[model samples]
Target: MLSYATIGVTDLNKSEAFYTELLAPIGAKTLMKMDRIIFIGKSMKEPMLAICIPFNKEEQHCGNGNMIAIAPGSIEKCDELYNKAIELGATCDGAPGQRIPDLFYGAYFRDFDGNKIAFNHFG
Candidate 1:
């Protein structure tokens, strides 16, 4: 039921670079860009993930218990994407592995802005 999600950042250039690499393995590309925000998705019309400077012109911070989960299509893809994320400077929250035997496999990390993100597959 979700349509899109956004996270606030202090540095738009840094956030853009980080997310461009983080989302590349999943084939998500830039869908739009405005002065202080950018939207990315598999297609322009699909659900998007946006990174932006806080509209209120205040400091940006990560939410206490919020995360963005990305499905990379399969267990292997999830692992690959997770590795790529780390290589591009994301800090690991959880390594890629089966989280629920034969049911869920996933990996977690925090972006440069400390926003949590995940890649997972369900079987």
Candidate 2:
């Protein structure tokens, strides 16, 4: 029942690019200016991470154990992004494939650091 989620990152520009590409399908809104902290979600929804702050790089991964599941508009979208991410130098932690066939069809990829992010589309 949450409107969004936020995470601290070390590099603002890089993380912005990564997330902007990653969250394209979900229509993620990016806003970060000292003058104002804009709301990503709609007026009725809660805000996600508004600003990108510095964090320890010594950490194992860019993300916590929790998996951020993004809903792809379609299976092809997932396939395209999954492939694009891999092509863009992201490690393919898991290939795009159906987990349980009809039930769970998705893909997982590792970000700049090491985060197991998944994208799914239930046909």
Candidate 3:
């Protein structure tokens, strides 16, 4: 039901570096780039995440209840990406662990621009 999701960023280049490195462990890479935006994903056919400067020429602010969750495939990945995100300057929203008794494992963080992201695994 989703073609892509976009998050506003103040600096495209900085956001690109943070996302590319943080997502590399899961095989996602830069798929395309336009004037003030960049799309990243495993491939063009898959859902992509776009980071860009807002077209309205206003400041970017993260929405209170907005977040993007990425399924990284395993618990180990959840931890790996969470740690990697921290190493790359993201602030921790939550640490990697079981959120549901035996169903969900996830980690959460806020990017440099304060967009919330989740590295998740659901069984």
Question: In angstroms, how far off is 87's CA in candidate 2?
Answer: 2.6
Ranking by TM-score: 3, 1, 2
Q: Candidate 2: where are CA atoms >4 Å away?
A: 33-51, 54-64
Model 1: colliding residue pairs: none
Clashes of 3: 0
* Cand. 1 TM to true fold: 0.94
Kindly list the per-residue Cα lDDT of model 2 for residues 67-89, writing each as its tens digit.
Answer: 66666678898888788778766
Pairs of colliding residues, candidate 3: none
Q: RMSD to native for every prediction?
A: 1.1, 4.0, 0.7
Alpha carbon lDDT at 11, candidate 3: 94
Residue 17's lDDT in candidate 1: 81
Could you tell me how far off, in angstroms, the CA of residue 85 lies in candidate 3 after the best superposition? 0.4
Please say which candidate is ahead in TM-score: 1 or 3. 3
- TM-scores of the models, in the order given: 0.94, 0.70, 0.97
Q: What is the lDDT of candidate 1?
A: 0.88
Order of the predicted models by lDDT, top scorer first: 3, 1, 2
lDDT of 3: 0.93
